[model samples]
Target: MKVLALEGQKHIKSFIDFPHDLYRNDPNYVPELYIAQHDLLTPGKHPFHDHSKVQLFLAYDDQNKVCGRIAAILNNNHNAFNNTTDGFFGFFECINDQKVATALLNQAELWLKKQGITTIIGPANFSTNETVGLLIDGYDSPPVVMMPYNYSYYLQLIENAGYAKKTDLLAYDVPYDTHNDRSVRLLGALQARLKRSNIIIRKVNMKDFKNEAAKLRDVYNQAWDRNLGFVPMTEKEFDYLAKDLKMIVNPEFCLVAEQGDKFIGFALGIPDINQVLRKVKRGRLLPFGIFKLLFGLKKVDWLRVMALGVLTEYRKLGIEACLYGLIIQNAISNNIKGAECSWMLEDNYMMNNAIEAINGKIYKKYRLLEKAL
Candidate 1:
């Protein structure tokens, strides 16, 4: 097998399309949106490129068929914010061939080494702010919206390449019917208790989304500061992401806690659009695919509680529980069947215990891997 650093439109398109063929027979494989992938990979299209660099590689067999792909990424903001010289590898895919997997990994390592990186970690498309981690456990079900999915053998391939687990991220399954309603039942009391301290919980106002997003960004940067691989997003990056999320963000599912105009915490849940995207053949969104996505929105029964956090100074005041409680209540009222509160750090006992208190079960585990360059 030969590995080549991908360049130009044709190669990038091939990189985005390879997974379609590789998982053609897999029932659970959901093709990511083609346009979304294109903008992400193209340098000028995504805000990530303004502060980082990514090099895509493709592995080809003797007959010139693509067998694997990987991306070597240098995230300047992560290093600057965390004070570590770490690079990242993401957008990785390969057949079950050791040769192809190793070749792709070696290429990424070599590229990172040349950039003066001492250690490399990922499956992070850019940073922890985006989709990161490998689907190390729970391969039986398709990943929720914005989550990663891969063949089970990927664990062996990555481990054999001399990479070891850096950390495990947890995904909890909370079915509406089965989840403990204690949190929701006590939500009113909790909100009243918080109100005593001048904190109020309410749905995000889409009419004033721009200004609201700005305030939330401040809390996001502070609340997630201590998380592994956390990197504060620049204004442009946050706005770029907010614009995309605005397309599917439900007002009721996005809640914010405020201390009389000072935002202190927030929780955001998005409809599982994968329910529609799964049927969008090859991830295309033109012609018929657009119609399917538009009409299929209301039929989606699942939600992904992608973000929930409170500023450190305001923790333990029952704000966290209230945020979760409100989201759960909204989910039930909307007729949503279930929700996945995901990508949580395994050792986050506080958050984990809170989810467990609500009867959330650990249904999936994803991992980040690292190797010294």
Candidate 2:
């Protein structure tokens, strides 16, 4: 086998298309949109490229067939914040071969070492801001819109390559039909209490998206700062992300909590666009792809509660429950069969308990791996 760096359009196309063949027989596998992958890999188009460098490599068999691929990334922002040199491996795909997996990991490790990196962690497609983690469990169902999925054997390949578990990211499923009645009952009461305190939960104003995103950014940084591996996004990055998500943000499900004029908490739900993207075939959006995406939106059966947070001082005030309840209520009204409130830290008891209170089941598991280089 020979390892090759992705240097041209052919290699790039191979890098993106390898997974289609790998998971062709897996019923739950979803093909990510090709154009989105291209944009993320391209330097100037993604904010990650602004502060980090990445090198992608593809493994080829003797006949020159693409058998595996991996990306070695040097996240300057992570290193700068933690004061340690850590590299990352992402956008990884491989056939079920230990040798190929080991070779790909070794190549990534060597590349990071040359860049003075001492530790490596990931499966993060780019960063925590994007899709991250290896799907170790829940292969019975297709992933939600932006979640990751991989063959179960990938876990063994990774462990055999000397990587150890760094953390587990949990994904919960909340069925609109069967979730806890208590949460449903308390929701109105909580909203009433919040109203008494001048904390009103309302839909996001698309007309004021810029200003609304700015306010949420402040709350996001403050609320999530204490969580494990949390990093504050720069204003530019936040705005960039907000612009992309706005296209899918449903006003009823994307809500904000305010105390008079202060933005205290928020919840964001997005249609599981992956359902449409899976049919986009290599992520292209030309010819019929764009039509499929646009027309498929109303048919999506699931929603992903991608973001829910309450400011630190606002904790214990039931704002978190209010945000969740509102999102759930909206999902039910829209006929969304189920929703995923996911990628939660394993130790986040507060959020987990709130989710459990609403009958969200921990259905999927993703792991972050780390190793000394």
Candidate 3:
């Protein structure tokens, strides 16, 4: 097998399409949107390229058939923010063949080494801010929106490649009926308690979304600063992501906590669009696929409680419980059957315990792997 640095639009197309072909027979595999993937991989279209560099590699067999693909990513912003000479390998996919897998990983390592990077960590499509980690468990069902799914054998392949686990990201399944209704019942009292402290929780206001997003961005960066591999997003990067989410965001599922006029925390839960996208063949939204996505929104029964964070100073003040409780309450009221509270750090006991308190089941686990260069 031979690995080559992706060069042209043709190669880029192949890099994006490889996963579809790789998982063609897997019923749980969900095809990510083709246009979104194209734009993300293109430098000018995505804000990530404004401050970082990514090199795509495609592996080919003796007959020149694509066998694997990987990306060597140097996130300049992350290095500058965290003070580490770290590199990342993401957008990785390979057949069970060790030779092809090794070649793809080697190519990425060689590319990063040439650029002066000393260590590597990932499966992060770009960064922790985006889709990251390998799905090591939970193959029984499809992933929720913005989460990833991969072959179960990938765990063995990555470990065999000498990558050690850097951390595990947790995903919990919370069925509405199973959740402790105590949180929902206490929602009113909790809000009143917060109000007594000059803090109140409210749905994200859509009419003033741009302004609200800017404030929430600050809370996001500050709240998640202590996380592993954490890096505050640039203004442009935050805005770029917020724009796409705005299209699918239900204001009711997006809540914010404030003290007087100061934003203290926020929780955002988006409908699992994957419920619709999974049926949109090859991730294309053309012809009938577009209709499926548009009409399928109302029928989406699951929610991905994608993000919930509070400023450091505000921790232990019941803000976390209030945020989570409110999201769960809203989900129930909307007829959403359940939600996935996910990608949590395994060591985040406060958050994990809070989820556990709500009776959320640890249904899936993902790993972030690392190797010294």
Candidate 4:
């Protein structure tokens, strides 16, 4: 087998298309859009390149058949914020063979070591700000849009390669039909109390998205500053991400808390576009794939409460509960069957408690692996 660095346009195409062939028979696997992946991996197209660097590699058999792929990333912001030189490996896909997995990981580690990195941590496709973690549980069903799905054996392959668990990220499922009734009853009262304090929760204003996103940027940076591996996003990066999400942002599920004219807290729920994207085939929208995405949007049954944050001074004021309640209410009204509030750090007690209060069940688990290079 030979490992090759993805260089020219042809190799780049191979890098993006490899997953389609790898998971063709896996019913639960979704093919990410080829265009989106291309833009993201391209240096100037995605904001990650502004402060970080990444290298893509593809492994091939003696016959030149693509066998595996991996990405080695050096996130300068992550290193500067955490005060450690840690590299990352993401977009990892390999055959069931342990040797293939080991070879891909070893190459990634060696590349990072050459850059003076001391530790390697990932399966973070690019960064924690984007899709991160390898799915270690919940393979019975397809992942929600933007969430990850992987073969169960990949876990063993990673462990066999000598990476230890760094942290486990949890994803909880809140079924509309069986959610905790007590919390549902309390939601009304919570909203009433919040109203008395002049805190209003409303859908995001699309007309003012630029301004709304700016307010959210402030709240997000402040709210999650203490999170493990947290890094403040640059303006360019934030805007780039906001623009991508804006296309699918539902005003009803994307909400904000306001006291008079000041934005205090926010919650963003996006339709699991992965449902539609699963049929997108190699992540391309053109050549007939666009219609599936365009029409599938209306039929998406799941929503992901990807982000929810409240200002520190606003804690315990029921603002967090209100944000969740509003999103749940929208979910119910839209006839969406369930939602996943995800990728939460295992140690986030406050957020976990709030989700548990609403009878959210821990349904999926993803882990970040680490090794001393």
Candidate 5:
């Protein structure tokens, strides 16, 4: 068995293709867009490379068959913000072999050690800002957009590799049709109260999305300041992400809170494009794949509430509840089947209770594992 640094196009393609074969029999596995992954891993294309660095590695067995993959990451912002020398491991996927998993993780640790890092933490697909964590719970269904899905054996493999739980991220499931929605019952009252305070909630104006996103970026930085491992995104990074999201963002589900032109808070619920991508074999979008993604948008039945927050100073003023209510209302109106309010820190009681008040069940759990170097 051997571990190889993924550098050349051949190695890079192998890294991306390994998972497709790994999860082939897993009914819930959704193949992510190949082109998007390519761009993200490519330094000049993904903005994360501008401020940080990542090195992809692939593990191969005696017969030269790919067995596992990992990305050893040095998030400069994560260290500077937390004031700790912590490197990260992400993009991990492997066969159910302990040796393969161990080799993959050991390489990541050694790479991080070389970067002067004292601890290795992750499955952060580079950082907390992207697809982070190993899906340790809720394997009954496919994951929503931007979320991860892995087999139960992964937990044992990671633990066997000596990675301990650092923290768990939560994902709430709000079934639009079946669940009793307390948010809907209280939404009228909540909106009335917010109105009294001169606060207005409205759909994002696509005509002015560029300017609106700019303001919301500031709110995002401050709103999540207290979350574990969060680092404010650079301007270029935020803009790059905004542009990608805008391509799939439904204006009705992209909402904002304002008081006299000031963007104080926002909530983004994007259609679960995975419903379409599940049919896009190999995650390719050309030929028939593009048609599946295009015509399949209308049939997407769920929305992934990827983000929702208010500035710290303005929090707990019913703003969080109001945003959630609006998201639910819009989702129901659009006939969406469900909404996933996800990747929430497990310890955030205020937000957790708010979601509970709206009948959002804790349906999935993801964990970030760590090992002291």
Candidate 6:
């Protein structure tokens, strides 16, 4: 077997298609959108490339058949924020072979080491802010919007590759029947009490979205500053992401918490686009996929509560619960059956408890792995 740097459009196409080809028989595997993936991997299309370097690699067997692929990434922003020379490996997919898995990892490590990184961690497509982690549990169902699903054996392959568990990301399932108006009933008192402090929750104003997003960006950076592997996204990075999200963002589910005119915190939940994307074969959204995606929004019954946070000083003021409760309220109002508030840090007891308070069941687990270079 041999590994080669992805050097051409042909190789890039192969890199993107490998997973779709490999997961052909896996019902739970959802092919990510081709355009999104393409733009993400291309330097000029992603803000991450502005402050980092990423190299793609593909493995071939003796027959020259593609056996695996991985991305070696040196995120200068991450290193600068943490004050450590750490690297990341993402976009990993391999057949059930230890040699393939180990080889793909070694190639990434070699590249990272050459760039002065001493530690490697991931499964992050690029970073913790994006799709990251290997699904270690809950393979019975397809992933929700923005979540990832992988072969069940991937856990063993990554472990065999000598990567130890650095952290686990948790996913919870809130049953539709049970989620309706529950948060409102449970947290009404808390909401009223907090109202005395001049905090109010309102739908994100689409008319002022750009400015609102900027404020939320500040809160986002401050809210997760101490998280493991946390790195503040550049304004360009946040704006880039916000642009994509705005296309599908529902103001009702995109909420903000404010005091007078000052933005204090926010939470955003998007309709599970996967509900429609699931029918878009190979993640192609052009020919008929766009129609399915556009017309299928009304059929989307689940909301992926993607982000929820309160300023550090605002914690314990019930703002988190308020934001969560309001999202649940909107879900209930819209006839949306359920919501998944997830990819939460496993060690975040406070946030975990908050989710659990709303009857969010821990239904899936994803792990972020690490290795010393």
* Root mean square deviation (Cα) for candidate 5: 1.2
Candidate 5 clashes: the total is 0
Backbone clashes (count) for model 2: 3
Where does model 6 exceed 4 Å of error? 8-10, 180-182, 186-188
lDDT of 3 by residue, 5-26 (tens): 9775658889989999999999
| Global Cα lDDT for candidate 5 | 0.89
Clash-forming residue pairs, model 1: none
Task: Please list the C-alpha lDDT of all candidates, in the order they appear.
Answer: 0.93, 0.87, 0.92, 0.89, 0.89, 0.90
Report residue 200 deviation for candidate 2 (angstroms): 1.5
Using Cα atoms with residue i matched to residue i, what is each candidate's TM-score against the true structure? 0.99, 0.96, 0.99, 0.96, 0.97, 0.97
**On lDDT, who's better, 1 or 5?**
1
Task: Write down the RMSD of all candidates, one decimal each.
Answer: 0.7, 1.5, 0.9, 1.4, 1.2, 1.3
lDDT per residue as tens, model 1, 1-373: 7999977666888899999999999999999999999999888889999989999999999999999999999999999998999999999999999999999999999999999999999889888888899997898988889999999999899999999999999999999899999999998899899989999999999999999999999999999999989999999889989999999999999999999889999999999999889999999988799999999998999999999999999999999889888888888899999899997999999999999999999999999999997
The alpha-carbon deviation from the true structure for residue 340 of candidate 6, after best TM-score superposition, in angstroms, is 1.0
- Writing each residue's lDDT as its tens digit, candidate 5 over 251-298 gives 888889998889999999899999889889989888789999989999
**Clash pairs, model 2 backbone:** 33-283, 34-282, 34-283
User: What lDDT score goes with residue 119 in model 4?
Assistant: 94
| Candidate ordering by TM-score (highest first) | 1, 3, 5, 6, 4, 2
lDDT (0-100) at residue 12 of candidate 5?
Answer: 86
lDDT of 2 by residue, 243-305 (tens): 889999889889999998899989888999888877876567888899999999989989999
Q: Of models 2 and 5, which has the larger lDDT?
A: 5
Name the best candidate (by lDDT): 1
lDDT of 6: 0.90
RMSD of 3: 0.9
Candidate 2: lDDT over CA atoms?
0.87
Residue runs of model 3 more than 4 Å from their true location after superposition: none
The stretch of ten residues in a row with the least summed lDDT in candidate 3 is 6-15
TM-score preference between candidates 3 and 5, better one:
3
